[model samples]
Target: MSNRAPLSNKEIKTRFEAALMGNYGLPAVPIASGSGVRVTDADGNVYLDMIGGIAVSTVGHGHPRYVEAIADQAAALAHTSNLYLHRGEVELAEKLLELVEARGKVFLCNSGTEANEAAVKLVLKAGKPYGRTKIVATENSFHGRSLGALAITGKAAIREPFAPFGVEAEFVPYGDARALAAAVDASTAAVFLEPTQGESGVHPATTDYLKAARRITSENGAALVLDEIQSGFGRTGAWFAHHAAAITPDVVTLAKGLAGGVPIGATIGVGKWGDVFGPGDHGSTFGGNPIACAAALAVIGVVEDEGLFENVLALGERLEANLADHPAVTEVRGKALWRGIGLAGADSAAVCDALAARGVLANPVRPDTIRIAPPLTITAEDVDLFCDILKDVLSTAPEGPNHE
Candidate 1:
């Protein structure tokens, strides 16, 4: 390695602001490196990574096994496009099907949005024969930013600006079976749902609600699409959160933690819905690359071998129990490792910034909700540290929203 000095935070910020688009605005912290469940910023300030790259770092940063898989795959073969069949892709697809406990076909993509886009086409084609044109989604739900996926995303703030969304969709209140049943009718092509809504403050749909969706859609001949993009791959103590419902969905979308921080996504079509698309239907250039598939395989293997699911359950219980009756918290939402701590009168954003300053990373998902999804591989000690730091930060949390 060269003996040159590292870029200072100010220098890095200047170049980043000048070069990158303002879509994400300015990054609050400039991360330099990560290991296990912690990350160091540009100024060498270390913080426990509670959010884990927005729930994408499944096996944690720089895991030896995960890194080895990625490196080995890249050295052997990286990109083959979708033209040629690859082993990693096939194996990953088979493994996902086995975990879902259903016979299905998997369509690989590079992100959750692309997977949802493929889902749109699948539902559209599946419904074409029945003259069904409408889709149903839940209010406050976030699917993706792409035009096709945005059509079904019910959050009006991000979705409304790109109006004339092309697809016909109805919004229903999440966890309300009656509204979902009422919305999904003969003309409905599909009912898209998140088993646990992650982006809009980690709210999990009830088991009964999901079962109702399955039954209602089956009766009306509409596809039941579960967007497990944020909840899948053991984030919820299971391969997929919908597994708890014991009802097979027509389609399911996955990404985020699938490849443990590597960019990858998958749209799984179950049963008859699997055969919806044939040649020339849809495709992605970098979808299901060997490196991504290998990484996903490694993650699955590690999670299973190390019993990380059990770890998630144990640590989750401990963490939730500690925060349950805290004075600064109103309520805790979500299941297992995926959680949202609702603040009591305190502003979520301000609390998060305070926590960051004290060496912990979290996300203010909503004005009053602070979301924390730590790596499943975290130990009991790590959980305790998080709880202690969170309590300390809350003691001096800013009174309200930062007006400045």
Candidate 2:
């Protein structure tokens, strides 16, 4: 481990501000230790973690099983590179493919961006010789910040700066089958979409729209790529949100919760598209490291053994029902534990701040939309506590500028 002395929150913040580039805009609270759904700040003030590290800590913080898995893997063998095959990597790949019924194979990486980047390259390579170059993506959809993923991402503000690296892609309104059908043609290489748009305020794609994408992509000989980076691994109560839509994407991008906070990403291709990439086409040095794969296997095991999906379904219903009656809340959208609450006149960021102050951690996707996606392993008491705190915050919050 890297040697460094622990400092107070203020000291840490000061050092971070001085050294790091200003991009994330500085975090308000500096957290120290965390367990389950609770995290303690430098001052020892505990807050219920509703965001789950932006939906990455699927099994909650410091899960014993995950910890043990990592410890065991470290003791046995940490890494052997991609040159020699490792059992943990093969097991993880098999498990993921079995879960999704993906026909081809799995390519592991480090983050959501890398997974999407790999998918983009694979689609481009496969669609070539057929003259399929244009990629169709939905408006408000976020792939990643990398050049390839950013090129296909929908947000014009995020994409405009990197226009030089932009690919031949078209944008269409999300959840609109007609628009997607119109956008995709024979020349389109792939149609990429998030199962549930997490960064764009937890907007879920309609089942009809997903079905339409599959149909259109198939007809046009374009690969259908579903980005489940934020909604996979029981975050949506189902194994994947696309399962609810009753459609199978040609390629699926996964990350965030796959390894229960461990940095890991996977791109699973289905059918003949899996063979698009030859052995020498793509590779990663630390992609399928044993430690990460071990962590993922443990996460998967715990999710299955603990029946966390059922918990997600039950608690999600309660959360949605409790928030729906709030006068300040305009809409609650999403399935299972992944939900977004739209406030009527309150600023979403202000509401999140208030929740944080009241010992509950939540985040705002926009001025009007606040997303609630706690860990799937969160208890009934946790949901009830969050609801109570939210109710109190909503009751006392002052009306702000209604930007939405």
Candidate 3:
């Protein structure tokens, strides 16, 4: 390593702002190093990581086993495109199918958006024979920013500027079976819904709503697509949040936590829907790269061997229980490790900043909602510390929104 002083946090942010696009604006902190469930900033201050790279760091930062897998795979083989067959890519696909407890075909990509884009193709093909082209999504639901996925994404603000989305879609109110049943019909190619709305404050769908969607899609010759990109890979104390719904979906999208911070996405098509795509339908040059597949395999192995799913359940319960009595908290949304806090009257931005000042990292997902999706490998001490710091921040949380 070079024996030179590192850049300060402010300097790093300045360079990033100057060089990078303004899409994300300025970062809150410049993280230098991380391990397990903690990260140290460029300023040498350490923090308990509750955001977990927006739920992407599943096995936590710098996990020895995960590191070894990626290193070993890279040393042996890394990129092979889709032309040549590789062990990791094939194995990862099988593992994903097994995790979903379904017999299917897998399409690998590099992010949640890509996976959703593949899903759009899968549903389109499935419905093409019936002369269907429209997809059904829900209000306040976020699919991705890609043209195809954005069409199914129900957020009007983001979809407005990018008008004329690739695929046409119908938007229904989330958790409303009547609206969903009414919106979906023979002309509908597929019904896409999140098991739990992640970007929209971590809202979960009701049992009846999901059941209705399954029934409606089945009857209408439309595929039921579950967007589990945020809720899959044990984030919600289950292999996939839809598993708890006791219903099998025709298509499912996965990413975010799949490779534990390594970019990887998957679209799993169950039964007949798996055979939708023939050659030349779609392709990704770097999709299912050996290194990413190896990392995903390592993550699944670690989650199973260490029982991270159960840990998530326990940790989630503890968090919800601990924060329930806080004066500033009104309600907690989501399940397992994927949680969102609804502030009583305090502003979420202030609470997030306050928590950051107190050595904990979280995301203010909405004006009144704070999101927490820590590494599943966090220890009891980590949870306790986060709870204590969160409570303290809430006690002194700013009253109103002050983005300035």
Candidate 4:
């Protein structure tokens, strides 16, 4: 609306390097605008968005209903601190509980890390009365960047630098029932786990593993906290990835796709744990903003109305069948669109760059793994196009340095 001119990709990168922190590195692609599942970069190149803003764009980019809901909410009312209640927040919380199918309370926050922090407090407080202090998490599990969430995250590189996180945490091999059982004991206050590990490549836990975790934590009087930041909100073709296990965790932290890319996070405490957080224990100023809640409501409505779950299942089946049999792919892991493609011999990072150059966007979650978490709104044709592009890229990709 002003006299400012749009910056080109080079200019954007220059400014980014000059002003921003190097934590993420300068973005390879400077996206200018997006429509549906496609994004146009500052260089005027169009790309099929497979990453979905790292699995945050639930309803796809610029969805009509989602846009309208956000606009309407913003125009009507925006921020009202935690001092007074609003309909959007209350309705969103109620809807979350209903979808979770649990009788509990919802603590709204701004990000997955904050949600986990609230959960950490709840579990620690619950255990304080009984002298329980330890927390058990899974190896390679990614919760968030916050110190509290980082303390429970089992990855060494990111969590180690900030020593003395104040939270006593233990790590166990993911999906190992015996290891988990061995790690959790009377002194354990909580067990934090992801239904599907997304960052270190999307690896889903078996039903037996999750059920065993539930049993073990319950027996040890430890709160079973499921971090569904990336795996929840229909990413696994279910409302929650943990639903497949048929076990209700005491605490579930949700974010990412919760608000169709709008910043929102939720911590649901099931049963008695919901009442654990009393006055002044925890809160967020912009946690339950009406705009984000409205966006979330719209996303949920669109997902149900359009039957995206069935679409996700159908596309998942199609994608797995195609990718798993590809000559360049060794294996495909994960559920629905949240897939991690194991490259047979190609370097995943190089392959992703090639894919991007050819107009498809994906994530190299590991050196040999390509993770795709496309939006649910994409059509069958979109999947076919992605498959074709990926096939072309991988076919021409060079062998990785580690290739035998």
Ranking by lDDT: 4, 1, 3, 2
How far residue 46's Cα lies from its native spot in candidate 3, in Å, is 0.5
lDDT by residue (tens digit), candidate 4, 1-404: 55888889999999999999999987799998899999999889999999999899988999999999999999999999899989999999999999998999999999999999999999999998898999999999999889999999889999999978999999999999999988888999999999999998999999999999999988988999999999999999999999999999999999999998889999999999899999999999999988999999999999999999999999999998777678888888998889999888899989999999999999998988999998999889999999988998888897886644
TM-score of each: 0.98, 0.97, 0.97, 0.98
Compared with the true structure, all predictions reach lDDT values of: 0.92, 0.89, 0.90, 0.92
When summed lDDT is taken over every stretch of 10 residues in candidate 3, the lowest stretch is 395-404
Count of backbone collisions in candidate 1: 0
What TM-score does candidate 3 get on C-alpha atoms? 0.97
Q: What are the RMSDs of all candidates, in order?
A: 1.9, 1.4, 1.9, 1.1
Mind sharing the TM-score for model 2?
0.97
Residue 343 in model 3: shift from native, Å?
Answer: 0.3
Runs of candidate 2 with Cα error greater than 4 angstroms are 1-6
Please tell me which model should have the higher lDDT, number 1 or number 4.
4
Span of 10 residues, lowest total lDDT, candidate 2: 395-404
Counted clashes in each candidate structure: 0, 0, 0, 0
Which portions of model 3 miss their true places by more than 4 Å? 1-5, 401-404
* lDDT tens per residue, model 2, 1-404: 64777678798799889999998878878998899989999878899999998888899988998899999999999888788889999999999889997677899999999999999999999887899889999999999999999999999999988796747889999999998899888899999999889988899988887888899999988999999999999998977889998888999999999998889999999878778889889999899989999999999999999999999999888888878768888888998888888888888888989998899889888788888788888998999999898888988876778555
